[model samples]
Target: MCLGDISARSQDQMILNLQGCDIPIHESQDFKDFSEIGTGGYASVYTAHWKITKTKLAIKQFFESSTKEIKEIIINEIHLMEIMRKKVIFHPNIIKFYGITKLKDEINYAMILEYADGGTLGKYLRDNAESFKWENQLKFANDIASAILWLHDNDIIHRDLHPNNILIHQHSIKLADFGCNASSIQLEILKGTREMPVSATNRIFVNLYKECWEHEPEERPDIDQVILRLNSIPKSHFDSKENEESEIIDELDLSDCDVQLYY
Candidate 1:
């Protein structure tokens, strides 16, 4: 169904909920200076300037070919964003969702998101591999861990997690691309029965990575434990001015924290 042609009741409810969550609905004219940045199976991403806020933003526009499927995906993502907004789970490492826009004479709505100047984390690592120090690598790991912790705590699983899905902006991590493939069963079973392989040589985070990649999900460490281990990395590995400055992990008290999984 076209976003603009939804049933009156559904449209009204959506508009009311969006207003309650402070998510603005705008027209295509609200943005300018569009440049196609990326393309995916269902949508094309563009860098545009939001005329209202004067901010550089990424606009994800779904294609019209698969209208029904694409519409559901868009609604699901927006609903997840609404939940994040309501629960106040806005973390520095998570990509920010601003609002949505309907293009002129178009059937689909576009998502307005934070623009990442540094591009995907995969590209960033490849470009700076030689110059990237352990301190910097640990920082990225901690950032990803923190975001994953928050996401898991809030019952959201980024099913399509990968280096490309994890973006980098201004030298920081921004978790992105929460697609519509939510597993019906909470338990995600790995295909193989073999134990997760670890590197031969000893490295500071090798064990941590191994624990996280355990064959059984139950055998893996929780995000909180992963974060605690990550926090120890900088303190245990290096004692330089740069490491001290690059350390971004905060003292988080998780004693009373509760993890709730929404089905």
Candidate 2:
């Protein structure tokens, strides 16, 4: 079947259960309060507190007025998350998925997720430019590579793997904002503006970066190979005094890199 035919079939199979059985509809009282944290083309993210459990959570809300096409895309995204939740199991580098909620007579539907207190990796890199040493960059890159390897082993392609979609929590990296089908190489190109730290110019790091951005998808190294290469790099390279004091490039322009969720 053509790609369009496959997509059409997938959308046709998506059925939303309004009865709070599979995915519950949480009442407003369940959450103490919600504050907007971020916004994408199809949904808005809010940080909410669970009244009884006293747990902090991230909720992505999708409006009801969205077109059928957009709703299908959202459903596909949710389906992909569910697949990962069941198949890949849990990994430290993968974002945790809670559940979905839809209120009665409300146009808003929400998907509850784990809240990363430290925010996106892109933001962390920018804010800590002075302190983002080579050692830390290597750690973050390894975390991301491990997560991608897990996803690929489960037969799922992230399709969107940029710094902005990589969240930081407790100084660790977690991959997020994926599901739609796209070119992996193209996604890397989209991340060019984020650029590697000056310290990453080491021969080993340079080779891995080039392999990741290879134009031919098949020519690109698998996440496992990428991880192996990253692990092979000498720790001393990152420990050099020059790398420690290297100035960070503060020219990241994210305006053009605003990737829409489920696009």
Candidate 1 residue lDDT tens string, 147-233: 998999889987766666778898899988776653333353455433333322125576777777778789999989989878876
Q: Which consecutive 10 residues in model 1 have the weakest lDDT in total?
A: 254-263
The per-model lDDT (C-alpha) reads 0.66, 0.68
Q: Estimated TM-score per prediction? A: 0.74, 0.79
Stretches off by above 4 angstroms in model 1 are 1-23, 67-70, 181-189, 193-202, 234-263
Q: Ten residues in a row with the worst lDDT in model 2? A: 1-10
Clashes of 2: 0
Candidate 2 clashing pairs, residues 3+ apart or interchain: none
Candidate 1 structure lDDT: 0.66
Can you write out model 2's per-residue Cα lDDT over 78-144, one digit (the tens) per residue? Answer: 7667666655458888887776675445554677788888888767766686777778888988998
